[model samples]
Structures are given as structure tokens and as C-alpha cells.
Target: MICYFSGTGNSMWVAQTVSERFRDNRLTDMADAVVSSNNLNFSLTEDERLGFVFPVHSWGIPWIVRKFINRMTIDNYSNQLIYCILTCGDDSGLTNKMLLKLFRRKGWQCRHIYSVQMPNTYVVFPGFDADPAELEQKKTAEAVPTLEKIMAAIVSDSPIDCYLQKGQQFLKSRIIYPLFCRFAMSSKPFRTTDKCIGCGVCVKNCPTHNIRLENGRPVWANNCTQCLSCLHRCPQTAIEYGKESIGKGRYYYGKRKDSQQ
Candidate 1:
């Protein structure tokens, strides 16, 4: 089984590609249940090969990913060979190390861990987001080969230090990630422009159900994960995080689609 959480098309595309490479592979979206309600637990099939494909958020696993692992309950997980594929924008900081712990706590071990550097998607923060045209093209081009390598590695059950592995920067990732989780996840800053047509695209894409159409407008809740799914996928480009994001590039799979509904 391949379980994944995708904010944009990047992770979803990767997850689908991986599922194609394996037989009897069922692609389970962890967000479907999470978005419907806050229920994080998932029951697993007995003795099936297990795989996870998710985006790296702030150099670590997204908080929802962590919660899913914590709440997950499965029968006979010990016989499953767990493979993890992390699609990261830049460097993944000690994410493998963190996952090792999570798997161990769940009484399962990751047999193969891999990282693929996909296009950057975290566009809410300044400088930490968006890439130039040339650079974006370069990253996406490089990802094709990287994805192939990940497919080969998982199929062969090869466990090696990935090419993109870098220093964990424990202080920043361990300290700052949680701090961001605590303070930066507020949805209060989101604003909808007059361009909003209330097509309900944001509500459909939100992983946390933190967005809702109220009186023909989208309302933001404090439970937002800052995944930017609503903002990045807004068809009318009607969503912004504050005055700072007014002119900021709205990024999805490397380009901005038309804002017209």
C-alpha cells in the first residue's frame, strides 16, 4: 500500500508514479480522512508491502504526518517492509533520522528511505518560497531522473544514504519546526480578494478542512497547517496571506495558472 499526503500536484504526482511501478499497489490518501475530520489513525492490511510518499515541510515531516504515525494502528505491521519517499523542495534536514524513530515506535522499520528534490512549494514565507523560471525548470528536469532512481531503490530494497542527504541542522529543524507549528499555523492572516468567485476550490483542497465557504466567501480557521493548498491552488488567485503576499507569485507545480474561473 502507498499512503501519501500531497498539498500541490508535486507530491500527488510522485505518489501516483510510484504506485504505477508496483503491482497490487493501492494508493491511499491520508488527507482524505484527515480533511474530512481530524481522525489521524488508519488501519493497515495485514502483511502487505508498505510505502509512504509525502512532501517535506520545513526540513521535517509535516505535523499531520507525525500525527498520523502516532495514531496509526495496524495488524501484523512487523512483516511489512516499509519504504519511505520524501519529495523535498530543497534539503531534507534529518527527516530520515526522525522517521527511523517514528517507525521504531510503531514496531516497524523502514527498509529503504529516499528523497526526491521536487519544485519548491512553501510560498507563504519570504525568501523561503518561490523560484525563478530557469531554476524552476532545472529542478523539475532533475526530478525526472531522481524519481527513477527512487523507484529502482525501493524495488530493489536498497537502503543507501540518498544523494540529497545533508546535515540535519538539528538546532534549526528540531527547534524551529515546532516553533513554526505553534505560532505560524494560524489561518487568521488569509484574505480573499474581490476576485474570489466562491467556486469552492479552496474548501475541496484544504487538508485540514480549515477552510470553508461561508456566505459565498472562504473562512479560515485557527487549525490551519499552513500547507498553502488553498492559496496555491486558488483558481482565481484570490487568496493571499496578508499584504505581503499581494504580489507574491502564486506557485503550484512550478507555474501560476490563469486566475479566471
Candidate 2:
């Protein structure tokens, strides 16, 4: 079983690519898998390999993914080999290490952790503008060959167990993560314009389902994941986090060639 959490579809694409190489594979988005507070369903046999795919945020796992992992109930699977694939915009140093430690605490024997680079979608960073169409093309071209190698590695059952030892060292010395979180959480909220068509595409694409329509305008709920799916998917360009997002280019995982009403 391959369980994934994707905000803007980078991790989704990676999960789909990896699942295509296996038989009897089960692919599930984390949001759809977790319903009630106490009940969760993961259809995996004792012999099946369990895989998790997700994007790294704030040098760690997304808060929702962390919560899901903590709440998951799985027993009687002694031979399960857990593998994790982390998709990131740049270096994923130390992120995998922290995840492995967390999984160890949960009694899961993690066999492998792989990091892959996807197009950077965190547009709030300084000088972070890129042509969305060109970036997608470049990512597709780069991902095909990289994914092929990953598939081959999986088939051969190779050992790829290099940990991010430097992450701990850097975190202790620089205090960078704390500063980043402070800034990220303090950013101004996004607002919707009158031009919003209320098609609900942004609501559907939000990983955290943070956006809701109020009086026909999009309103961000409190528990936002800050994955930027809503701001990027607005067809009318009606969503804006601040003046910064205004007039900035938008991106989508799949081609936007389809017509919009």
C-alpha cells in the first residue's frame, strides 16, 4: 500500500509513478483515508511493502501528515518494510532523518528514505518567480529519468540509507527553523476578489480544505497548510495572499489546457 499526502500534486505524481511499477497496489490520499477521529483503514497484507509519499515543509513533515502518522493503527504486520519518499523544492537535508526517527518511535522498521526534487512552489520566498508553463515542462523532462532510476532501485531492493546527520548540527547552531516558522505563520492572510467565479476548484485542491465559500467569496479557514494550492489554481486570479501574490504567475500540476467557465 502506498499512502500519500499531496498539496499541489507534486507528491501525487511521484506516488502514481512509483505505484505503476507494482502489482496489487493501493494508492490513497491521506485526507480521504482518515475520516473519524478513532477509525482509519489501510488495506495492506502482512507481506506487502508500505510506502509513504509527501512533501517536506518547514524542514519537517507537514503538520497534517504528522498527525495522520501518529494516529494510524496497524498491527500484525511484522514483515512490513516501510519506505518513504519526500518531494522537495530544494535540498531535503535532515527532513528524512527526522521522519525516520518519528517512524522508529511508532515501531515501524523503515527500510528506505528517498528524496527527490520537484519544482519549487513556495512562491513567497524572495525572487521566487518562475514561468509556470516552462517550469512544468522542465519538471516533466527531469522527473521521467529520475523516476525511472527510482523504479529500478525499488525493483532491486537496493540499500539507500544515508541519513541527514548535518541537519541536527545546523538546527542547533543556526536556529533557522524557528525563525522560518515565525515568519511563515505571521504572513498576512489571503483574500478573494469580486472576480471569483466560485467554481470550487481551489477548495477541492486545498490539501487541508482550508478554504470555504462565504457569501460566494472564498474564505480561508484557520487550519491552513499554506501549500498555496488555492492561490495558484484560481482561474480568474481572484485569490491573493497579499500584494505579493498579485500579478505573480500561477502553477498547476496538470496542464491547464481544459476550458474553464
Candidate 3:
């Protein structure tokens, strides 16, 4: 089974690509699992490998992903090969270590870990915006080779160790990540502009279901994980995260005609 939580489609693309590599595989969306009342339980077949794919948030995992992990339960007893794929805009701090600790607590051994750099989708903070067209194309293009390596590692019998593009582990993960979780995540700044046409795109694309239509405009709830899917996916480009995103560019993984596998 492959469990994933994607905000702006980068991780979703990775998850889907990996799932297609196998003839028989199950795909679960962690965000949907969290919102659903169904129990987070699954029985892995002997031949099926367990995998987790998600985007790196603030150099760490998203709050929704953490919540899902806390409630998740795998029924099978034997230790199957568990793998992880993390998609990031730049670097994933010690997010892999944090995930490993979570797995250990759940009595699961993670055999392989891989991180892929995708186009930047986070643009709420100052000095952070979507990558330029060339850079975005380059990152997406480069991800193909990295994903190929991940697929190869997953099928291998020998245990594949972790490989992470962890930059400033102590500062980003230990210090900055905690701070970001505490203070950075909120939906207060989300608001629709005059350009908003009551399209309901944001409401539908929100992974956490944090947006809703009210009087022909979108209203944000407190459950937002700051995924920026609503802001990036808006067709009119009318959503803004306060003044910081006023003139900033938006980005979400859109498959191009010439995109390579």
C-alpha cells in the first residue's frame, strides 16, 4: 500500500508514478484518511510493500500527515519493507529522521528513504515565492531520474538505506521547524480578492477541507495546514496570503505536454 498526502500535486505525481510501477498496489490519501471517520487500519499482503509519500513542509512533515500517522494502524505482524518518498522545494531538514522515529514508535522498520526536489509551491512567507519558469521546469525534469532510483530501491530485496537532502538539520528541523509549526500555520491571512468569481476551486482542492463557499466567496477555517493549494490552484489567481503573497507568483504541478516520465 502507498499512503500519500500532497498539497500541490508534486507528491501526488510521485505517488501515482510509483503506484503505476506495480501491477497490484493500493493508494491511500493521508489527508482523506484524516477527514474520514473510517479507522486507519490496513492489512498488507506478503507481496505488497508499504510506502509513504508526502511533501516536506517547513523542512518537516505537515500537521495533517503527523495526525494521520498518530492514528494509523497496520494489522499485519511481520515486518515488510517500508519505504518513504519525500518531495521538497529545496531541502528536507531532519524530516526523514522524524519520520523514522514515528515509524519506530509504531513498531515498523523503514528500510528505504528517498527525497525528490520538486517545483516550489510555498509562497506565504517573505522572500519565498514560486520558482521561475526555467527553474520549475528543471526541478520537475530532474525528478524523473530520482524517482526511477526510488522505484529500483523499492523492488530490491536488500535493504536500501536513507538518502535525504537535509540542509541545516539542527537549525531547520530542531529549531525553525518547531517554530514554524507553532506560529506559521494559520488560515487567518487567506482571503479572496475582487477577481474571485465564486469558482469554488479552492474549496475543492483544499486537502484539509479548510475552505468553504459563503455568499459567493471563499472562507477559510482554522483547520488549514498552510498547504497553499487554494492559493496556487485558483484560476483567477485571486487568493492571497495577506500582503506577502500580493504580487508573488503561484505554482502547482501541472503536467505539460512535453513532460518526460
Q: Which 10 consecutive positions of candidate 1 have the poorest summed lDDT?
A: 252-261
- TM-score of every candidate relative to the true structure: 0.90, 0.85, 0.94
lDDT of 2 by residue, 68-92 (tens): 7877767666757778888776556
Clash pairs, model 3 backbone: none
What TM value does model 1 have? Answer: 0.90
- What are the runs in model 1 whose C-alpha is more than 4 Å off? 35-47, 166-168, 254-261
lDDT of 1 by residue, 153-215 (tens): 777777666646567578757987778878887788899999999999999888777788899
The prediction achieving the highest TM-score against the true structure is: 3
- RMSD (Cα, Å) of candidate 1? 2.7
Candidate 3 residue spans exceeding 4 A from truth: 158-166, 255-261
* lDDT of candidate model 3 versus the reference: 0.86
Error (Å) of candidate 2 at residue 193 is 2.6
Give per-residue lDDT, candidate 2, residue 87: 78
Best-to-worst order by TM-score is: 3, 1, 2
Off by over 4 Å in 2: 34-37, 41-43, 131-135, 161-174, 178-188, 256-261
